[model samples]
Target: MSSCHKCWHCITKRTRKDATRIVDVKQTKELSSPGAVEVDSPIGLLASTTAAFLGRARRGPLNTPVFIENFSEFRDHFGGCWSGSMLADAVQQFFSHGGTNLYVVRIANNARGARIDLPGPNGPLVLEAAEPSSTEHVRAAVDYDGIEDEKGQYFNLTLQRLAPDSSIVLDQEIYRRLSCQSDNVLFVGSELARSQLAHVCNTVPAHRPDSTGAGYINQTEMGTDGSALSDYDLIGSPELGTGMFSLNKIEEFDLLYIAPSMTSCVPGPAAVLAAEIYCRRRGTMLILDPPETWMSTSDALEGFEEAGYAHPDVLSYFPRAMSSHSATREESIAIGGAIAGLLCKLDRQSGPWEDLDQQGFELSHDLLPALDIPASEAHRLVKGGLNVIVGQRPGHAMVCGSVTLAHGSQSGDQFTSLTTRRLCLSIKNAVDSVTRRTVFKLNTAAVKEHIVADVRKYMDELVNAGALKNDRFSVDCDTNQGEKRINCTRDITISLTFDPACSDETIKLNICQAKSDSEVASQYA
Candidate 1:
């Protein structure tokens, strides 16, 4: 009988090429059956068959149905101990080739120390474990989630989804196993997760602390020491006392009207706040709406007062109970839409100011006459018009001057054609008088009626002549004064851009308004 040697040297020697020449002799005392003697065959055949079976048996038991189909062995040329990189590469290749999951077996001599290196698709990884005593090592290694060694050291590996924080929540057992050497563990997952983790580790904190007086300290105030409010001296310095004073001022206007609907409130409040801020910064006076009138009015007022501006008195609220009854959601939406349209038109008008000079037109000379204003006053009127137009485009209309040009200059000739391109109208009621009355009292309804009639007549003519695709011009009016007094005052104003050369005579006629003494006449040839 031959004894089995588990020693690496003994096993290698037995399997070496030199061992093939060794002879095996077997003799039988008697044959149990005449046919059995022939079936047993020669000693050489028996030795060859037994050696092959032993070679396969050394790998492990074949309890599991799944088995490795293709296996290759490579000798390490470096003679150094095996590493995880080698094992990781094999695993990566196997997975890449459509192998869903797999197990690896590493065989190394005791002196060399058993270690397997695999290079995976993601990156290189290593697996280290002790040599197996029997074929059971195959099953033990496959089922083992962590290492169990005599030194009581253990390691658990797991796969999981990456968290938003870039950390993975490991199973309790695995976490316990890895807790001892957390630094050695590596996480493998999606690129997004990796990126998120990188962001968290790289984020920087804001240096300056938040201010109580204001939400945040001004960046300009931050000094080299990274502290705000650090520059002033505490001693009896006038500058120090001045720094503590409020930096804003309040201005009073004729009336303060707050829009009733939140829809109307949107840009209105923002505009008011902006106006307040501007006034505060410039020491201008502004009459603010009542706190209870709009939801955000109180906060806005408080903010202004805190910023050092004087508190304003609220005069009235808009969409008065009676007037509101006549207003519909559609009307509000239409008003909003019209406001947006006006804003767009104004934007288009003002944006081209920069390009006006390139067109051989000075804003003070050629462009002003087109709108019908004198050269000297054209710049001022254009600027005022821009401000009012921007405000009115969104229903926050204000009385504004229009651009005019010098009457006699041939320079005005170049602008006549362009000036005729707009429908010019003007209203000159006293600002204080117009704002004192109710919406119904303000003769705006009648003015709006006349404006609408003219718009419809012009649009109809344009539509008939095929100059305009649709009759879309519309108008609405609201005022703070009574009807009789409103009609008496010339406070409301409106203008439109039109094509003077359009085939529609009615539309063309409405392009320019008759000149008045107070009126800045627009010249359109």
Candidate 2:
């Protein structure tokens, strides 16, 4: 980086007085986010959980995404989305493949859990489901015929909170002959607080709830599932700092994934484009799931044409993944989460530069490529800017290609390779971190010399670390000699250029026969 520093110099006036004049002194310095893999994904959580953990991410100027460091926290907060949603499955698979530092952005609209009204002397007491979901139906019954307490006004209160499907009772509580009075030996407030599925409203009845003829009182006005979500719901507003964009508040993340619900409904094109733009701005890679129409190689090409995401910041995986669920076998789910897990695995086990298409790369036990892709078909998909998995069995499911879904004239082959693109991002981030610290320093010779030295030192380390090819890289931060604006006080310019280490994706070999043994040996070698 280079900046011009202005200084005042005293000049003696010929006639009477001394005057101070300003002069521009140009200073030049040459310089370079370094960290492990961090992945972030947007998931829709049950409405009940959002209120329980509202602002749990500690919202402020930097509205950091909620950091889920372990599996238990994920299960406790985001495990069941209504009837055990797809988010639970995706999170389980992500953790199973050694993913760490996972951040989840839970999406929820205005929806409350099931509510029930109990008959009371003063008024009907209202109770709401502990977790938010329309399917969380709760029931209660009063037993006045049970053993009477000392007051003879007490009754047994039995409450049952059913699952989303109402197939099983998630929680049950029976307060034996408990008085409903606010200040009694065993008040309903203290007794009902132990229920896991529902909680009492603010108001408490003065007397015990009347018996409902020994039958359970069902909830009226069941909660609605709220509005149908769209891309806007997921992207949200930057000003409001919600949804996927909220991930920007965090310090750094390596991979970002936004998977569609298991219903096979892909996120709208606008949301996907917004996510792509965010990844580009943050120096992160996005793993995109193929459209529902991408069942075959031809379909994948057509899908790319329709979507038209000609950006190297994204990697598209094709032919949905086949994994068996407890309820079903050979279920086709979105592969974006699994791909992200693999990327994290690669970054940890092997360096990021290592090709992901090599043999021996394994997938989770339950996952497999949905389609039995032949070699020719796989090649066709790879050329069309889509990554493909070639194998069919566990520990044999190797990623056959690692290409980005980029096309058109402006895009070049250099960015088409995922490794090369990631390397370029890594270099830019490293250099920016160092140079931004020297923004307003004095433009003196000593400063310039130190800046250049610092930059060269970092670049040299990168070269030694195999991130850069050699010392052919150069850092130029001096003022432009040809420009008259070199004297401009406010102008600062920086130019950084380097050749990132690129891996060969293909090799060619030729075989020939010779008459003599020596010649044949030489040719073979």
Candidate 3:
């Protein structure tokens, strides 16, 4: 949003000045250390969805999270995307692979919105699209309808956000009893301020806009989709809250992903590192895609080491899938969405704590691995922190490895397994959610007990669901937490130890996520 940033956008394609080292090694190691945990309370405040996606789209507002319950909703919202658009593919694959709840945040790469002009008595009334995109088509209509103003002082206006195919109205706004006079309460600008489709721009005409024929079918000036996404566009500035940072506005999500593959063109190294850090901070997992450079197994191993991407919170795989692109043509595509969907299905059928290896996780669509990775090669990739998709026949492809990007002395043994890491995240989210309910309550003796009992109850609930091993956990709290209690700080630490049903090791946690007063704890048990 600064002048310098504005110039960065002027470039047709952004290239990383320092690609060899995208992140500070020392800082990354310190952050990834097992001892470091994102303990901020506000980050744990929302009810989380199964997953979320941020990427380039042919439509929708930039950096705004749109919750999608199904694929139909996605199609209806982001209508008429370019053929083979990464976002559209990912969403379609997600539903095909059994994912139910999702949040999509569309990102703009210096795009512009379409504008329209309505004929008015003195001049033209201008209106602009609320969200920029070539596919952001809107139609407006002005009619006298029920107006009694014979002098044509007032007119009814109808606005519709139409799909690119112009077959459906995604959204519609209707305004009645309106006048073009600025002094009138029904002025176009005043009423348009509340419109979702379009808003009035420039100046208001002295009289109402001339009526369009029939209904909301008046066309607007075509918009420009702009250029493809760049690494700068995806990483976005945290201060400006663009790109992944805009996710902070959302209540909650478990996993984050980019629809486009993690190639040098889109996500690249810089974006991947930024996403990993953000995911760790949010207690979520970043479903990293195979870099486009990984055309083969050997290249993937060498590339993995060179990239220095050993974060335990990042999950990645290699050897893209050969998906049917057209009736006679096939194209290679990243399988990140399929993996995320597999995780979602597993999370529901069993739980996030369920061991993925034993789950027999398979790709849903008729997808075949671009490379036929042998068992030995697959094992090597797994050891190197890269998963693989194995298929002997069409529609029989299955993921081979269920590991995080924590390889060789990362010392994050606790998170090496995807199941264990997810178990910890699930436990953390559960504890935070349960404790947050006590935020507004008085920090009294009974309230303190309520906090402890509530958390204990949740742990018990997890045990009942077979996600955790049966164990009695203790909640550590200050004897007094009301008006005046030890430094008068409304903070209490809770410690619990448990074993995850899907994990082989016993886990211990000291959850101190604070707001008002509460002691929350979780462990593998």
Candidate 4:
């Protein structure tokens, strides 16, 4: 497709100014032929060939130069070929070359393997295979306290570590198992867990001096004999009172077995709040095992509502109206958990959260009827009309304004006037849908043409009544978008004095345009 000069030429040209020797040979024969032979070894050709081979090899697998930092050693061992061992060697070499992190791909085959050794200073180290089938499994193995035995039952409180050699095997198994599931599980975590779990699982097969021929099936019985459960089997954070209080990490397991002596130390309200927030943000499910009571129904409902509404950016565009219903504290907590999970699932099913927000706004017009609010009001509320009373002290408070709308139309003819009315109604409906209220009426054509004149008259009336000392208001209109739309903008200020015992006063303003004889309201439904 496209060709460019090689780096060698550039480097040579740049260095020639500081160096003594500079030659431009058109052909290899000029330097190597009998009459002008400069050197006999052809070392440059060998170096060029080697460099070219290395360049091609780099792109062929992984495409990471760090992976093959020990190129000579790798070439000698795997001969620069593409193989699992070659990849492994490359990875190891990469790490050896001060590369601390890397991801390895393990293909399922008879020869596939990984080597691991406990961190140490000595050269000789013990190595073994890591066998894990999924990220969940890997997490369980790494975080939980046991292993699945030959009998398909988990041995709780067991301590285990994966051997380096088995790391790749575990990674491959984990990838294979999880690749079949649609859930968004982290691959790296899954592989690591799988390897550790496999190691623990294989402990019985490997046999230890402490093993009583009875095996893991009888390990529980040993616990009754005053043996420490943690010593013989593995248990996750929950059993140890350190598990996630809101969502259990081990809920991913199909069948979880806990020791009779195990006790759950559920999280507190703060934990529940954090978990709910995390789940809501991630759009994933957090399964809590040995469920614990956290926030009461009222507290949960209040918290969710407060949180939901406070973030207008999110609530304004949320596709569904969020509400809570709980008869009991437990039920409320359960509902809260469910809501968190459902939101995450919905988010994933739809798309990214931001995309969902945009799409939600587009679909929100249909939800006004269910909310028992006018479509226009709902639209305005969402655009920013309604403000949640966060901390309203006696005379002072905070309030936010809603989205503003301004439009103008030309009276071309009967048909054109009718079209303008319909458009205005549409705007009204959209605003009503967001605010859940209606607050405007259409004005006569004579009044519409001179809105500023009417405002001035109102201000004069207020001043004459001693209700206004100084009128401060502004109005302006513009024709833009190729003069197809006229935008009317306005700002108003009013001051009032009320009786000492009366609560704060709020005034409502309604504005509309007059309609021609041909204008008619169209059915919004």
In order, candidate lDDTs are: 0.23, 0.57, 0.68, 0.22
How do the predictions measure up, each by TM-score?
Answer: 0.15, 0.61, 0.78, 0.18
Report the C-alpha lDDT of model 4 over 1-525, residue by residue, as the tens digit. Answer: 111212111111110011112122111122122222121221110010000001112111111112222345334222343321223332332333223221111212122112322211222122223321111111111111233335322111222222222432222111111111123242222223433222222112211122112222111111001222231122113343222211231111110111111112322334334433433332222222122221222332333344432221111111112112322222211111122222233223431111212222111111111122334443444333131111112222111121111111121121111112222222222222221111111222322234334344544443343333334433221111122111222111111221111112222222222112322111111
TM-score of 4: 0.18
lDDT of 1 by residue, 462-525 (tens): 4454444345543333322323222232333333334333223323221122212333221122
Q: Rank the candidates by TM-score, best first.
A: 3, 2, 4, 1
Candidate 2 or 4, higher lDDT? 2
True-structure lDDT of candidate 3: 0.68
Cα RMSD, model 2: 20.9
Per-residue lDDT tens digits for candidate 3, residues 239-341, read: 7878887787765578888877222334778888889878876778998877665677899989878888888788888787776333422356777777788
Q: How many residue pairs clash in model 1?
A: 36
Identify the runs in model 4 with alpha carbons over 4 angstroms from their true place. 1-217, 220-269, 272-333, 336-525
Full-model lDDT, candidate 1: 0.23
The candidate scoring highest on lDDT is 3
| Candidate 4 whole-model C-alpha lDDT, 0 to 1 | 0.22
Which TM-score value belongs to model 2?
A: 0.61
